[model samples]
Target: MSEDLSSKLLGPIKLHLRVTWESQDSEIKEYIEEGIAYIDGICGESDYSVSGLPRILLKAYCRRAWSGNTSMFEEDYRRQLLRLQHENGVRRLRRKRNE
Candidate 1:
């Protein structure tokens, strides 16, 4: 993610995490990066709007990571992950066809 996008996402993620201190900013930022990687790993590269499905999943992933329960994240979010994957696949197909 770009630095501008990361900074934009940080505040909402912090709010979702209920983090009222700057002490964990770096850690939270790391979580954001990890969440992006994890989601993209499943769904392929795509744009992430602040309030889109990808962003929602990213927040949940970060939450799980923050609480050290990442082991179950895939299982817990299996449906959402699949949906995102399908959506991305369709988008890619459409882009290829258009080209």
Candidate 2:
């Protein structure tokens, strides 16, 4: 994408990540692309319009790219799993009262 176009598309994630409109840095671009791809994989399809918690996750993943850390990824992945399970109605079982 052109710098102009990419800049226009910058949302909270980009702002928080400090990705610039005139970003000629290859590393930033690569990490941002990786973040987008990661989100796509999680959703099981291609997605460009990102926002809300997913946007936060995308930023976190991109930051991880900069940090080169796996621990953050593991924690974030676990959080995503729990969120998915909750959304799917996989609730914890409640204990029964004794008679």
Candidate 3:
């Protein structure tokens, strides 16, 4: 993710995690990066802007990570992950057809 995008997401992520202190800003930023990368790996690269399903999943991923439940995140979010994968596949097909 770009630095600008990361900065934009940090505040929302902190809010979601109920983090009122700035002490863990760097750690939360790392979680954001990891969440984005994990999502991209499973569903392909996406917009991951501050809204939409991708962002929702990213926030959930971070929550799970923070709570030490990262291992169960995939199982818990299996349906959404599959949906994202399908959507990304369709998008890739459309792009290829256009190309």
TM-score per prediction, in order, is: 0.92, 0.53, 0.92
Q: Where does model 1 exceed 4 Å of error?
A: none
Model 1, CA-based lDDT:
0.88
Cα deviation of 1 in candidate 2 (Å)?
9.9
Candidate 2: residue 66 lDDT (0-100):
63
Candidate 3's TM-score reads 0.92
Candidate 2 residue lDDT tens string, 1-99: 345423433554456667566453556666666766666555433223545555566667767876787356846577774464444332222212321
Predicted candidate 3 versus true structure: per-residue lDDT over 1-99, tens digit per residue: 887777889999999999999998988899999999999999998877748889999999999888977998888999999999998899999999999
Q: Clashing pairs in model 1? A: none
For model 2 the local lDDT of residue 23 reads 52
Error in Å for residue 28 of model 2: 1.3
Top candidate by lDDT: 3
Looking at candidate 3, the ten consecutive residues that score lowest on lDDT are: 45-54
lDDT of 3 at 76: 92
